[model samples]
Structures are given as structure tokens and as C-alpha cells.
Target: MFLEATWPLAPFVGGFCTVRHTLGVSQTPFDKFNVAYHVGDNADHVAQNRRTLDSFLPRSPIWLNQVHGGRVVDINESNISECANNQLDADGLFTRLTNTPLAIMTADCLPILLSNEDGSEVAALHGGWRPLHKNIIKQALRFFESSPEHVSAWFGPAIGPKAFEVGLDVVEAFCNDDPNYKGAFVRHPDNEDKWLANIFTLARMQLLALGVKNIYSDDLCTVEDKTRFFSYRRDKQTGRMVSVIWRKYP
Candidate 1:
């Protein structure tokens, strides 16, 4: 978990953001802590792992389908049952409801947790290259009444720029959106048609552009740290890590 800054929203209103590693009793690929259901891991083991995760929180988290798109869902107490019965097709989740953990799963994709000061609102985003190019961070912030300046963000573990190589089209997507994004990419030394994209840098640029002042990150690279994280780029059949954010009862 990335607990670097004294969680801008935790102290006042009792919300916190945390991440879980891929460590559980599931077999190879998933190994110990995979929380995703569609990843082909044993169903019973996945269920057990989810239960284990719930044991550490105030309540079960609201999990989504995570289509790597910019769709953000605002969850409240009223629709809690509906959300559970019908899985949401969104990549980002935010809530004002107390004790309802909003979670997003990721392997090599970036998991971002955002919250307002005093913990009145909190959100989590599953950011892959597609969502990043689409500016999902800005899209997620639109769910809250607060301005971007009043929000703080924490970036969970993901494939670092040195390990995340992308095609020229991705580079074009970013640069075409904004030329400032060009700095977030580096030409691959071996592959002429490929470039290394800095996911965190791209994310930071988006947040800052939107006027979000406080941003914290976990420097750990998922692709490089095989023991602590699961990387889709490194292992296509790997499990995903979950990052959850919620408001604690006062």
C-alpha cells in the first residue's frame, strides 16, 4: 500500500486508500493474493481471497467490470444492492456513502485513489493505457462536487516507464491529445516502432493540468518486482491486485 503522505483525507473525515498485493493460496499464476474473478483462478480460492480481503475492511468493496474506459460510477447507500446484484460496467468508482469500499483491480494497469480533504468524497480508478489516453482522472473528478484543487491522489503500483513499452500509435494518441505528453514517452533503443510510456508521468500531467495539487505515488514497479506485484506484461496469465478507498464511520 502507498501510505507515503499522511493521507490528506484520512485524518479529518476518516477515509483511507490502500492496495493489496497478489499474495494468496491460489495456484500458479494467481499464487497467493489474486482478487479478480474472471482471471481463470479457482472459484473457491478466489472467493476465499475476497473474503479474506473483506476481513481487513469495514465492509465488502463494490467491484466493477473495469473495461479500461472512462466511465465513472457514483455509488450511494440506495443503490448498494443494485450494484451488488448487477455488476457495474465502469472503470472508476466514487462514493460519499460511509463504509462502502470502492475498489478497482489491476495487474500492469495503474490504480489511482482520489479523495477530497476532510474525506467527504473518495474515488478509485483502474487506469490502463487506453483510459490514460482518454483522461480518466479528469473524468472521475467530475463525479465530485469539489474542485480538483481540493482533491488529493495516490497512485498504486503499476508497470513503470522503463518496463512499459508501447507502439507508436499509443505515442501518437498521447501526443495528439497534447504535445506536452511527448515528454512522457521515450523512443525504444531496439524497436523503432515502439516507445516506452511513463504511466505515472502521464497521470501526473493530467492531474496537475486539472488543478489537483497533492499527488503521491508508490515507486515500486510491478513488472520488475515479481515477488511483490503481478505484471500482465511479464506474465500474461497473472492475477490482479486490488486498490480500495472508502469513508470510515465517525
Candidate 2:
């Protein structure tokens, strides 16, 4: 039901990625445990699924109106109400407040959970290719009062390199940003004009370049793990699993 994030951080920081489970109410393509309402799942079913997930969380998560950009919202008591209403249009969320859970929903795009060494600050990012190319990870790290070396990051399940084929333009876009990113792509096995991109590697490169060292990642591939996850690339219309992070009250 949950793929808990395993990383070195103060015990107060908590995070996990939800997986599809038979117990949820979403039907057919959504199967079960689909918590996103914008994915064409039945509204009532989505609500029930969210409520069920909320039961395990300290507070209801602040869902984002993700646009696959670099914007990161600083979540605080002042704007918590608007964030709860899902009125924020951004791909990343950061907060220092205890019990305020931040969430990012995705099928194949990567979900990254981050926190300072002592767990005083935490953040969640939606790491689609567009956002990554736009330097979303860098944007989120800037919210931390701690330096990059004091930050730890955990990457959730995503479309792996073997299945994430892309065009020359995609490869060029990344390589143009930094030559180091060239290592994250290779010629597709079946198509010479296409390349298989490694989203995880690309994210790692960004984090490493920004001086963050304590990085951990899940090797699970959403496109290959049909039984445990949802994949939009595999199924155009599908449900979304959410990755959430928060710091418990001291």
C-alpha cells in the first residue's frame, strides 16, 4: 500500500509513495487506490481514496496544480488554506511547519522528497522531464536554510531508462544545459533517431551538481511494474499515485 522512503534524516521527517492496492474504490483503468481527481476517475471514488490515504497521514496533503514547471511554493500557515484547496500552480512544495504534509502526484514522472539534515525543513517535487530540464530541483533546494550538503533527497518510482524513449530534441535540450547530462541518454535499441533517457540519472546529476550528496532512489520502474504502479506512458488514461512528505511535531 505504501513504499516508504528510506533515507538518513532526523526521525521527525516522514515520507512515502503510495502504490495501487485492491482495497481502493477506483475501478477499471484506475483499478484501485487512485487518489488523483483530475485523471478522469470517478469523483466520489477519488474522494474516498484520498480520505483513506488521509487516515495514515498527520494531515491532509497539500495537492498542487502541477504544470511541469520550475516554480516551488513555500508552504506556511499563511498560505496553507489555499494550498489545501489546490489553488497553487507549481511543481514543488516546501515547508518548515510540522504536520503539514506536502504531496506530488504522478504515474511515471518522478516524485522527489527532500529534507534538511535535522528535519527542520521538508519539500516535495514533481520531477517530470520538463520540470527537470527547467531546474526544479535547484529551485526547491533554495528554500532550505541549510546548505546543499546538509540536504537529503529520496527519489520515488518513475519510468526507467529502458522504457523512457525520446527524440533527438529531448537529448539536445538536456545536453545543451550541461554536457554532463549527455551520460543520461543512449541511442534507443530499435530506433537510431531516438534515445532512451534515464530520468533518475538526470535528476541525480542535477542534485550532485547543486552540491547535494545524500541522495537515495527507488529502482522500481512504473512502466514495467504494472501490478504495483500506474504508468501514463503505458496507459494514456490512468490513475495517479501520490508521494508525500512531512515533519512530525516535536
Taking all chains together, the TM-score of candidate 2 against the true structure is: 0.97
The collision pairs in model 2 are none
Query: Which candidate comes out best when scored by TM-score?
Result: 2
lDDT of 2 by residue, 139-191 (tens): 99889999999999999999999999999999999988788889999999888
Which lDDT tens digits does candidate 1 get at residues 216-237? 8765688998877778899999
Instruction: Please name the candidate that would achieve the greatest lDDT relative to the true structure.
Output: 2
- Evaluate all candidate structures by whole-model CA lDDT and list the values in order: 0.81, 0.91
TM-score of each: 0.93, 0.97
